[model samples]
Target: MAKIDKSLYSKEEWLVIRNRRRLEKQLKKQKEQISYPVKRKSSKVAFVLGNGVSRAFVEPEVLSKLGVVYGCNALYRTFAPDYLIAVDVKMILEISKSGYQNTNTVWSNHNKAYSNIKNINYFQPSKGWSSGPTALWLAAEHGYDDIYILGFDYKGLDDHSKFNNLYADTKNYKKSNEGATFYGNWLRQTKTVIRDNKKINFTRVIAPDNYQPIELNNFENYNTIHVGDFQKIFDIS
Candidate 1:
């Protein structure tokens, strides 16, 4: 008879304890996020983009008025908006003793290993998704109505960048474990969802580009809230 690797069980138990403490801490702190709930304002959703150049155009003051600004981890470092949603654990933070690969934005909630946001939900990794649009779509599924995508540039080598690529140490990719899309990629997929679900009254706010604005306008019931500039349209007065 072969002996079982009993050592594996101890590591598994440790993971459970670690994950449990993390969840408990999140539940305790993030309850304050009720202030940013979609119900509080109604069917208005702002798809706050991360640190892409397009974000530079958003005019932060304008975005805040519509509702809660759920910016990416970059926002945590700079904007520090009312709500912050970090999708990948590895990207936003790196657990290294030497601090070799650590990039920007370390969570201030350093005491507890799991502390990220208060009341805001941390994205659990979804397997078999290609682009960041998958995450945005998931966000829509979670009930963010009138979705507005601010900065999803996807700008990198060959003008293609993955959500987690910014922090990757090695260039290996497996479809099983990667985060979602941003900018133009996120916008297009969201629009497709709206079109596919013909009967749904989906309001998607996005940047005004040459090709998209015209094509989307032709669609019958799709109410597209194409803004000149989020900063200007919202009138950050």
Candidate 2:
């Protein structure tokens, strides 16, 4: 740990600094001691799992059997995908505390704040993107011929008036009664990924009543399929 000038900081600030430095050192040491397996590129198909309520019935394990699975924050509590992506600080801290990165593949933006947690891979170029779109970008980076986006409903569950998430009531998430989060950034990021990877077909699976944003329809490589139709196509039932 670097030497701290005690004279410059108050007691509470000094204590917080000391604790952060200690945690960073511990994480760095743990990273150096463990070895992780290199990911294999065996499949051309990829499934990016978003936390939208539309995909509540879809089983990640079932998708895992078919192709590579990429999931976002909080999903780790129930399912460990082929690759997990989390960019939020609170979510990353929670994941680190649980020691998930030690055994599973996790991807996040590179930050000096959490640089010592080197057990997981950091995103190149560090776009500082949201978890769902970042996961989509990661899937596109793998050169998958087809990417299916599940549970990416852009609106709230209750007719766009409330929160719409599979884990809304759980820790680190907004309550179901909370107002809907703005989807502008997510829409732009998702569109950028599709536009950049024109060769890759991007299929978004949604429920019958799920909101279909007008912006996405402009992309030639992007298309939306009903969740029931997607299930039938994949024999997921």
Candidate 3:
């Protein structure tokens, strides 16, 4: 924990901080530490990313069959998800105000403003991770046998635009052509995490041909499958 600047924060502010810490500590104790390769019940889960391609390619019917849909960033604006996640401080704070709905929301432990929000889960990641990959890790921890990722286009800059995400306009998120810098780093870290946990099967659902498969060391864990196959795998109409 970083040393708090005592001069900057008043007693009330300090009290809130201490209370939040206490709450987070309690939450951590109750968190389930899911062991890998323990069981395989044929559960199918989908993690929907903010890339524009997901909006274009993945259909609602296919998403409905994926057992659960974990929406990233501003996905709530476009589609309803069983779980909504945000690790970015700004996005968490923003969504906490408006989209606090029936869906289960998981937020970073660093953002204490989300404390009062109902149906919210707090997670303290072992390392600094971006929202998408972190969501993958969390899903694996929850024991989903098969995980599908949709709209995870790694293209940070197209030939024409700086915007990388589909919901940037609605969420007021900044667009950068240099998406490869930050987004690329996140992908590498996420791939490492996926490689470490090989028990869970991960499929990139109907991604473009340009988005190459994330290779694992000493194993083949990741693959690309069509959205139609996603429906068949889960037996969803």
Candidate 4:
């Protein structure tokens, strides 16, 4: 690349140009860093794990044995799934500080801000989506015919008033007493994945009282099952 003639442009104009160039370079590096596993013809089942409280009683070890597992965010603190997806800067930093990224397959949007983290993989053409939906999308992209969504309660507990994550009150998370995080984005993103991947089957495992968004029911590819039945089917005692 030729040297930029900084003196030829106004300070503000130069700043914009510099930032654009920097982003382009970062995107290039991110593209190069992407590493995907070999797609197995026989690999048809996948599990996409979220941090919702409904799945608190479930063990990731049991699911890992059934298929490829992709977990989101703080799920890494407990069990390292086959692929861990975290987009939030704080959580990414926490994972990096623990040196988890050094030996694990973690994916995140490529940002110049995280240039210091050397081991994790960057998603090419970054989705800019939240971790749970991103994990779902990744699983769909891997050609899984059947994908089970675990812990995606999609709303708060206690009539949607309280925080409902398995990792609430822990590091990099809100206190259990805090109000629920908005679910609009998660619902829309999840619906988009289902719409885009019509061929893949998505079964959301929900507790009896789990909030069900009406929008999801419109998708033919999407379905839901009570957590009790899920446990019985999987023999997850």
Candidate 5:
């Protein structure tokens, strides 16, 4: 067995642990505060974004007006949405651990812009195998009325056919993604989640030209939503 790092248990680590415990306590105190019926209903259209969303929709006002669930990268320096939700902490940790300090720097800078934002949420999978899909599925399972995934590209920025092209490294901090194959597992789970849940009114659309054929069929709800259509649907204009 490897020796434990005594330095890891230093003052900074203790302080973070203390804060987390305190936060949990405070949250438990709010159990009563959550008993009230939810006033604000989930939007008819909710958006999920990843890096793929960057260039796809130039005029995304329709999506912008509805609820937006931003990915980790989207939660960056000096840019953010009115509301946001994040998953894929595993990926973030990898990037953060690359000796680049990218995660902390980006979050710190972007948090300033999001200070006035109303709701910021985060969720994780039950386990590693279930992370991304579960996060999206849970959003709809709980109370989100409609979900529109904007930039959840699940591929590299330059790749034409594949999505999430950079997430496959099960090896190192800066490992190859085996070409974003992880998302295939996520998409498969997502399809079943959609099929099993009928009460939920959700539609998922990938960006223009990014749709993978046979795989897209797995999702029964992959309808084409145009820019104008999104505006009319969400009344963003």
Candidate 6:
């Protein structure tokens, strides 16, 4: 378990470091061929849920908008999203016991403890990816044209109290800012993906000010809406 000083690296700088570490790890492991899941249907828009301040504003009806929902980490605890992604062992254990059988869960190899869990898609970590980045990659690979991400605020990196995920109180998770640096890595990695894929437009809905818009069309125009506003805007009721 190596660590990077969060104080020393900007989010972008940390991305460089994280990518290097991933390459080194892959080289050491000889790059196992991974069987990626089949590309999902090409939905016009998809939602990627993150645990952030705005997470409290989302309702189950907003997630039930026919648009595919890709939730990361503890999101499944609150809503049965269409897709769930996790790289943490504790989260995997929690989801396994939750008995919510609708979503397709994807877990990285960070914790191999849940490999025997049937129907859960296990992803081979290629170059040190986190849950959020892996989920974005899956959406992009699946040919989704538009992706709206929610609750992915990097505010906790500066203000620890903003780490208010629903599952923070759960066992094995710190009730405070347990992994701010890691969250920053996810942000940086997601930024890289958004920049690399010009065809796929990535939109961060209800994101905090710290998250800048990527170089995608209509990104600047995408308004950050509250739950009520989102419901009204999308006619979710």
Highest-TM-score candidate: 4
In model 3, the runs with Cα more than 4 Å from the true position are 1-42, 48-55, 99-103, 112-119, 125-127, 175-181, 213-218, 226-237
Candidate 6: the clashing residue pairs are none
Per-candidate TM equals 0.45, 0.82, 0.67, 0.83, 0.49, 0.66
lDDT of 4 by residue, 64-88 (tens): 8888899988888889998999999
Clashing pairs in 5: 50-151, 53-151, 154-163, 154-164, 155-163, 155-164, 155-165, 156-165, 168-177
Q: Cα miss at 215, model 4 (Å)?
A: 1.4
Instruction: Point out where model 2 deviates above 4 Å.
Output: 1-38
Candidate 3 per-residue lDDT, tens place, 183-222, comes to 5666686687678778877777654443554453344777
RMSD of each: 13.6, 12.2, 11.0, 8.2, 13.9, 13.5
Question: Mind sharing the TM-score for model 2?
Answer: 0.82
Question: What TM-score does prediction 4 earn?
Answer: 0.83
**Cα lDDT tens digits for candidate 1, 1-237:** 234455666988867866877897787665543222342454356454444443455566566667645455434434545444444444334322323214322222222344543332333322223234443444454455455555444433232433333323332222223443444544566567566655444444444541244555556645545455444556743
Which tens-of-lDDT digit does each residue in 131-202 have in candidate 5? Answer: 445545545554555666555555544463333422223332233423344466766776766676666555
Off by over 4 Å in 5: 1-42, 54-64, 68-132, 154-182, 213-222, 235-237
Residue pairs that clash (backbone atoms under 3 angstroms), model 4: none
Report the lDDT of model 2 for residue 146: 92
Q: Write down the worst ten-residue block by lDDT for model 5.
A: 102-111
How much is 118 displaced in model 3, in angstroms? 5.1
Ten-residue stretch with the least lDDT total in model 3: 33-42
Ranking by lDDT: 4, 2, 6, 3, 5, 1
lDDT: the better of candidates 5 and 6: 6
